[model samples]
Target: MQKGAAERKPGETDDELLHKVGTGNWRAVRLLDYPVDRILEAAGAWKAQAAGIVKPWLVWCAHPDWAVLQQKLVLSAGWTPIVGFDPRVSHVPIVPGSLRIDFNEQLQLPLMYPHFPVELAFMWIDKIAFWHSDFLLAHDMMERVATQFESLPQGECFVTHPGHPIRTRLKWLLNAKDARYWELLGCTTKEASKSQWDNGTSWWMNFQDHPNCPDKVEYERRAKCYYDHGSGIRYWHQKCGGRVRFIYETEIAHGHFTKIGNPDFKRSIPAGQSDSLRLMEQDMSRNFGLVEAAKKMRIEDLLSSD
Candidate 1:
């Protein structure tokens, strides 16, 4: 269990908030009944470390294998990547050219919630470019995107992809009760159902089931305030006077851990009792690479191969 996972009562004292920060438990601080922006403010000392870096590329990285490869690809294209990592990830890649933000020293909110980082990025830099570390883009496309974002006028923002809409739409329809799915549905204009918050990701601070959000009004406010990538882009677009645009030039290859493409990567699970033994070594090996390639291989050579 996570440290400081205790149920926080409503109207938590300032002392409690300070203690949570002092303990380096940003996850626990997230569960407190306060706005995320306020929580970020309280973490000023820790978060300020990254505030000085105002880079254009914000790469949200998780696993080392993917991050290493991504760093290679991005650097080869002549863009400086500002990579963000989950605080709890045991292995973070040490790429020389990339600026790294370890959420352990900053706010450890779920990176899946793109709004969190986008908001943070906007605090320091304008006209930012962001994508997942698992994404594979050609050198030409990277150059194109870098040039596109750099040339964006004030009050303008651009997103290269709309994401996998068909799969996401089906997932939302099948699991309408889940609020986590709602964010990705790109339906910010509609009212979200209460069940969506009730059956959402339990660890999310905004969900109805979370102990910190015991009050209906509080949870509702939290739920409504959340935004996924599509909603975030739209929100900024409207806020910036309709300057946001989605440009589809080249399709980016998302290297999903479960899927096979790279000859060095594959996901494997045991035959029976998949749920019970799903976390065994065999299953884990499938998702994670055996060695860190970013450090060993040449960037040009890695990008040259399929």
Candidate 2:
């Protein structure tokens, strides 16, 4: 590998950056330039010295303010943060189990396929689950699903009036799925319908939105494929994954009912955590095929602290 060729790191391939980091390789440490000593060391003291390389993968899922807690866990377990992402997908700023509710309405980004130089953007699906008071946080969560949109307002809102800064901001918020809806709002120009490549031409696609459009069915299928799904539950449970149960009782016009499904809510995540911090543990375990490893690490640190 060329010394500065940006060649893949040892034990890391472009494809398996997540898995490679599951091993140990400190060079990939993201936020390497965060100025821990410069900003956090004195007042908050966030920097950790390494005796050797730290696994960029294998992290913990934690809220911020729990930095010392997470780092203490990381220090003992020999892991580090190569990537981080905060779950701003809550409705009422209050999670059932999680103490704090952070609602960023401008929450754009699907939190998926991060375009940044990140290998893994640690997410707490289970922790974020509590925010799914059905109607409570489901709509907000769907709006901010990184690159996927599930409803009308978010997709239809894509069409912009000329020189509309608000529209520009809305456009900026659009993921490919939402972008397609600009046409559903009555598109005649090429700009609105043109499909773009995500990674390559093989993955080219356009945006979408349709009234009573069974468009979301495919999205529901994808979500069910990744998460759990059930038909025996209430309507909102099936549509918004039971996160926004409030929508269950509401009557939407047309056959918007097809998208509904029982939400796959689970206590799979550990909540009651901090607000700003991100953890690697659950993510690492999820990808590494070790369910108990993350919990053990968190417990060990908690016990060791006292």
Candidate 3:
């Protein structure tokens, strides 16, 4: 039988308990079933520490549910929220206290490339962060990123999660033609053959202080280069002079490949295994609510404008 919370040894801190749980100590398994409110409260407290260390300007591109969820997470994590979206879809509701940047109006790059809006947002803020919409952030994510940034070597342009190990290796074998493609871009053998370093899902940087910061025109040019080459990761690595460091962990849960059409996708929830499925459903419900609210507000604004 596992010991309950009340049975904890005297003077054992929550951090110590969590550490034990992380290390798979049997004594800590009882802590796994914490009440949801307790977890939220703990996360809320951690938010203060995250906010104090580095309050990044978040720039996101995604649909309504993702936008709302991302906004909620960042706000709770103590960061300013900024969203970039296609005005044509226009379904992403205006999140309270968030600045929305319309990618169609502000960015000249093609919609096929998702990172352009992030790059646009990157130019607007001193300390900026960009991440994919499908990621759910851990409470201490920003604090970790900030601490890593402070400890980075001088002249590093960004810090990001390491690219997926399997995919990074497979891309070279699968896309051998990229060898010539890379050479055409004037890449050295080291640069061409280097493992993909940054995954682009979550990264932070300050353009003002970055030694290789490109101007708007140059940024766009490089973006187009990435689009042409079909690899944003490669473009960042090459153009930034490979001055990127990998975080030990991104502290984000990725559901990017969970939807249909993915090889490993599975949507059906088994009995008593509702954690991930329940969260997805809850996010969808919230997203739908926000979309309806935005539509109603948009109609009212149009009537007033007329």
- Runs of candidate 3 with Cα error greater than 4 angstroms are 1-54, 59-61, 106-114, 120-123, 146-155, 159-240, 247-261, 264-306
Task: Arrange candidates by TM-score, descending.
Answer: 1, 3, 2
lDDT of each: 0.43, 0.22, 0.37
Q: Local error of candidate 2 at 163, Å?
A: 53
* Model with the higher TM-score, candidate 1 or 3: 1
Model 3, span 93-171: residue lDDT tens: 6566676654344222122122332232222322345554444434455456545544443233343333444554477
- Per-residue lDDT tens digits for candidate 1, residues 121-203, read 33444444666443455556556666665666654445543335466447655752332321111111101111212222221
TM-score, per-candidate, Cα-based: 0.52, 0.20, 0.42
Off by over 4 Å in 2: 1-55, 58-70, 87-306
Q: Order of candidates by lDDT, top first?
A: 1, 3, 2
Model 2 RMSD, rounded to 1 decimal? 21.6
Sequence-dependent TM-score of model 1: 0.52
* Model 2: ten consecutive residues of lowest lDDT: 126-135
Model 3, residue 228: C-alpha shift (Å): 7.7
Return the top candidate by TM-score: 1
- Note the residue pairs that clash in candidate 3: none
For lDDT, the strongest prediction is 1
In model 2, state the lDDT of residue 256: 17
